[model samples]
Target: MTDQPTTESKGQDGPAVVADGLTKVYDGFVAVDHLDLTIERGEVFGIVGPNGAGKTTTILMLLGLTEPTDGSARVLGMDPARDSLRIKSRVGYLPDEVGFYDDLSARANLRYAAELNRVPKAEIDSRMDQLLESVGLSGTADKRVSEFSRGMRQRLGVAEALIKNPEVLILDEPTVNIDPEGVRELLDLVQRLRSESGITVVLASHLLHQVEQVCDRLGIFVSGRMAAVGTVAELAAGIEKGHTFEVEVAARAIDAVTLMELVPGVRSATLDGERIVVTADRDVRPEIVELLADNGLGLLGLSTSTVDLDSIYHTYFTGAVNHDNVNA
Candidate 1:
């Protein structure tokens, strides 16, 4: 490891991870542009983008495996570049493609990792058994990795990352190539780790649904820049286009078109059979209910046709959103 200058501590109460203008340039081609991000302790933060959008590069920088050309990153209150070994001791990383000795049993593979992490010999057996059970691999602990399925291997990879009892776990495209059941298990395991152990998680993936399922907050990356960062609802509100809600109402004195004009935030309302579809800047469900009551309409059903991650991605990449609205 190359020597680097030490940085002042940001204190223990600060975020678990902090990237300040973190950039990486390979032969003048920018892989990751100036990026600023933070992940609070015990938060399941997701970094999402299309292929080559710099998600992996950013993760590498955070792990101190790849040195940044410009800017800096800190993990667990230590500079990644200068305190990499210390950071690695407390941080666990599972790459998209995790490798293990094919001939080695799952238990053996974890034993190897434990040795590398300098886990005490006395504690190795107990830790390995606990990790295997935590990752749902205790039954296959003695099975050769060569015979393990993709899902099984992925679970073992997670177990390997946990051998050191890391405070923060970083998974890169962990759900890729795994079966749906495996994906669910992995996500559940991640959530359990956070809830039970207070481990901060940083998940990087192009898979929107996986991120949506496990992450507390999400950062959308476009062309090596963080386009937006927030919860699902916050991102939806940042866009100019409003969410659409479908309402089924019985006979009413006021029609859908007239109701649109009467509501304060409703931008458009169209009648489709017995259902009324209303689009608005924000959730107008309460206003909608009041309007129905005032108009003497009987409400049968009400549902918000939510704005999903796909729509948010499309809007941001296609330039539908005014850049000023982006959280940066």
Candidate 2:
């Protein structure tokens, strides 16, 4: 492996992307509001939210396509707003809706894009060939882009982003047009990029399941602002730690709650017909089994339920945007 210089050994120079109080306003309407984010090198960071949540707008600013109304942002130590050309050379972007010249062959389309990016003429052909093969488009290299399927086009778009082998990759809804199988392939490629090159990746998507699989850290956006930023486990532990569980016992619902109250770790217990749910600090499986076994209460089934990603998003957003007013 080539010994590439990393941001870590450089200390304060560790962050690959930084946004300090970033904001975008349009005709008195705020799109992105005082957002602060940091993305470290060699990490896959994910941003998630619903439609019109300023996810696309945020990415535009990061790519030097949208102007920030307040504060500032930098990619690879250069201001994207002011040093667009410099930043563009160091970062690769894949938009949510990828478009291409329909009449041109895959090879021809990539050749045109490569020239625009100013890739060396001598290396362009070989690089394009490698990228096409990497994305499973080698067989369709001579085929016109118009004949390609939506999934194929998406794969080509990914190849286009990697043409220059950028150090930082920014993708917006990369899995939108991809099939389930294609989604898996695309995700695997993304993981390979980070592992092989240690490239800092910024992925924006609504697929929380996919995000949870790849991201080392995540930022949840709501109403143009970041509502929460942390790892999956950290967020769960902090917000959902005190959640209550429901318990039910066959024909003796009241007895189940009464028996659960005797357990040392169980904070509270509630009963429903034919089943019981218990909420406790730690995993209640062992205690529940012991309690049922010792009390001679026939335990038919036991399950644990906790807050999921959607639940977490709602909890923060419902409070962040109350009665159509955004809170500071």
Question: Candidate 1 has what TM-score?
Answer: 0.78
Q: In model 1, which runs have C-alpha deviations exceeding 4 angstroms?
A: 1-11, 241-306
| Tens digits of per-residue lDDT for model 2, 164-187 | 777788888988867889888888
Q: Estimate the TM-score of every prediction.
A: 0.78, 0.79
lDDT tens digits, residue span 1-328, model 1: 0111112222267789999999999988899999989888878998888888899999889889999999999898899898999999988889888989999999999999999999999999988988888888899899899999999999999999889888788998999999999999999999877777777889988887787878999898877888888887778778745567889877762475587567888777887766777778788899888888887887888997767778788876665566567565
Model 2 CA deviation exceeding 4 Å by range: 1-12, 249-304, 313-328
The C-alpha local distance difference test score for the whole of candidate 1 amounts to: 0.83
- Candidate 1: count the clashes: 0
